[model samples]
Target: MFTSQGPSLRELAVQALSSVERGYDLLAPKFDGTPFRTPDRMLDAVEEALAQEEGSFGSGLDLCCGTGAGLGMLRRLCRDRVTGVDVSAGMLAEAARAHPEGVDLVRADALALPERLWNTYDLAVSFGAFGHFLPAERPALFGGVHRALRPGGVFAFPVGAPIPVTSPLWWAVAGFDTAMRVRNAVWRPPFVMYYRTFPFGPVRTDLERAGFTVETLPLPPFGLREDGSPRWRLLLARKPAAQYG
Candidate 1:
């Protein structure tokens, strides 16, 4: 599912064996050519949904903004400043080259956001980066996002509906996760990317614990499954405007 401009099989193998940060660093230059890059249609759907929900925002933040694909969406939605934070310097470099003006790129782990970022953004969005975080890391990850936003600010991302057990896609994801587990068990500096770890129910619970009031909006462009369930929903986790002591 990669273009001719994408990384070669041997290059991908080398990346898979490296740590998450380093692997992404190696992959950053060609990241946009790969299927791993968030699709423009998905970003468009989210931008439309967010505009309908909250007409316009002030400043915005993009968590784990690899190659800054989501920054354009933020720029469209936010009136003031737009920031993209990532752990990989190489990714940030590519992002910088693409978006040289009207965007701030920060190199920092998503789980441990700097205090300067706390309460600074009116909106925050992440695209296709959650798999790198383990289930146990959700609390910290969500908590950091909570702290990063102002009161009534939002943290939103698209989440796909669970694949049916009978589907080939489900089996493929399951196999990938199994292989990742096996690799992590034996490899040094494990690359913690698993497709199955971020379920909607558990993730909503974590967001709630992180002081967000959570809700979802169906993205109609992606359509629904055979069972009449939305194929994708945008998770809107809002920090409350007021909280009692």
Candidate 2:
């Protein structure tokens, strides 16, 4: 419905009625053509932000990496292995088709990531998938990511400015979340997606509780809101490197 190449209205309705994993499986082929795909401008901005960090890394991981939108950037930053993990098999297949080489695409849940992920990865990133996770699930999600990384590995993602109540977009976002909640209430296999669930304050606290030292950097490419606050911020969650006596 978004464009000629994007999924049709009926396709989107079918996806919305199915579980999140099944929905993405149906949408995988045309996912990139849809607005759901993270924009290259945002990805490039993130890559630029990561570059300013400590020089080249040994490996990188794209947590919940969807169609692998961030994989190419991870490939550019990490000197060695680059991997993409997602719960959706169809999404991984699309990622594999897109990346073709220099990436290990694994199918796994972000909330219950495998033990094999321990102490691995110098960097990890995710984009536009936060809405899939509910606020109550943050602990498991963050804790799993905490365990997935090696000492000193960084996890980064962007946070857009909170929509002001006066803005039309605020109502639109609120309405969408309301609709999703209603849909989930009656549906058997709930399609979990909500816009307002990932507030930064709770999220930062969750990350810190999960063992990350968290901070934020403004992404200037997206510019500032009228209030002078940044329109977007890059959240960095760093795991402390191992120390010994």
Candidate 3:
């Protein structure tokens, strides 16, 4: 579901065939025009939830920030500085164009953050980027986020509920993930993206192992399931103020 301004089918095909970073670089310009951009409603809900906790943070970061969709949300939530980091230079260029004033765009891989960034952020958020990481990579990704934040700092993002196996939506996502796998199998610099891989239970466990006290707050914007469980939730993981040595 892309807007008229979004990339054409051929453009999308080219992106899918390229490496994840290159693919995103190709898609960076029209990224916001696609459904891939994190919705404002989810962003607002997270801002509200984080606002309830401690005082305003000094700096914020959007890890795997892409074209900086989450940067604006961080700017609203953090009073001081807001920065976005991604591996795609093209994405950073577009982000720079959009946020010229007081926004720092860093081109860096999320998996291996620069040592200078360790424990430097007050808050961090990522939007729709987790699926790019494999399940085995969650621990390191979570650890990097943990190290990027100060003690008691937060790392948050929205996670949607899994579609029912019986639903057409399930088939759609399954088919998409399956096709992505097939494409990666046949392609070089494989596009390491999958939809159905991230699960809440394993994520929480990894977060805990990474020294974060994880919590989930339901997002009303996406509403609830038939069983009244939230269809979408914001995962807020805090690096504890003190750690047992």
Candidate 4:
């Protein structure tokens, strides 16, 4: 998927060898040209789904927003304000350049979001950034998200169905994950990205533990798998509004 516009294999290898934040910094300028950027169709599907479900939002947060891919979608979905947060300064710079007028880009770690942002957003969403977090980090990451949203606000993201053992894609991802493990083992700074680490069941549990009531809705555009399950589902986790007794 590397066009002349995209990063070459050697550049990608250099990025892979660096830390996650630094790697993303190096990849920022051409991030949108790379396959790692979320596809437009997936963004449109999510925007459409949220439009149908929540109707609208006051303020929205894009968690681990890489190069502001989903910022425009959040802008249309949220009437008041839209913010994109990521740890990489270079990615933020690219996002700012692309979305100069309407978007607010923040440089911050997703796991330890600033307290100033607590209870600030009415909706939160992330795309293709889960792999950076280990399963152990979900609690802190989710708790931060849970705290970021206003009571009754929803956090939404898409999850693909597990690849069956029979699928060649499954073997490919497995091998990729194995290679990553080996690389991290030998590397100085660990770049914690794994394709198979973010399973829905455990992630749902983590969300529940972080005080979100979670549910899933099928994203029909991606179609169904052989067993009739949706190939891609939108995971909607909502924080319960406070009660006045």
Once model 4 is optimally superposed onto the true structure by TM-score, how far is the C-alpha of residue 207 displaced, in angstroms?
Answer: 0.4
Residue 215's lDDT within candidate 4 is 93
C-alpha local distance difference test of each model: 0.95, 0.90, 0.86, 0.93
User: What are the per-residue Cα lDDT tens digits for candidate 1 across 29-71?
Assistant: 9999999999999999999999998899999999999999999
Worst 10 residues of 1 by lDDT: 236-245
Mark the 10 consecutive residues where model 2 has the least summed lDDT.
Answer: 236-245
Question: What would the TM-score be for candidate 4 when compared with the true structure?
Answer: 0.98
Instruction: Please write out the lDDT profile of model 2 over residues 75-176, one tens digit for every residue.
Output: 999999898999889999999999999999989889988888777888989999999999899999988888878888888999998989999999999999
List the RMSD of every prediction in angstroms: 1.2, 1.7, 1.6, 1.6
Cα error of candidate 2 at position 201, Å = 0.4
On TM-score, the stronger of 2 and 4 is: 4
Off by over 4 Å in 4: 243-245
Q: Candidate 4 at 176: error in angstroms? A: 0.6
Q: Tell me the spans in candidate 1 whose CA falls farther than 4 Å from its real position.
A: 243-245
> What is the Cα-based lDDT of residue 16 in candidate 4?
95
Selected candidate, larger TM-score, 1 vs 3: 1
Name every residue pair that clashes in candidate 4.
Answer: none
lDDT of 4 by residue, 81-180 (tens): 8999999999999999989988888899999999888888989999999999999999999999999999889999999999889999999999999999
Q: Candidate 3, TM-score vs. the true structure?
A: 0.95
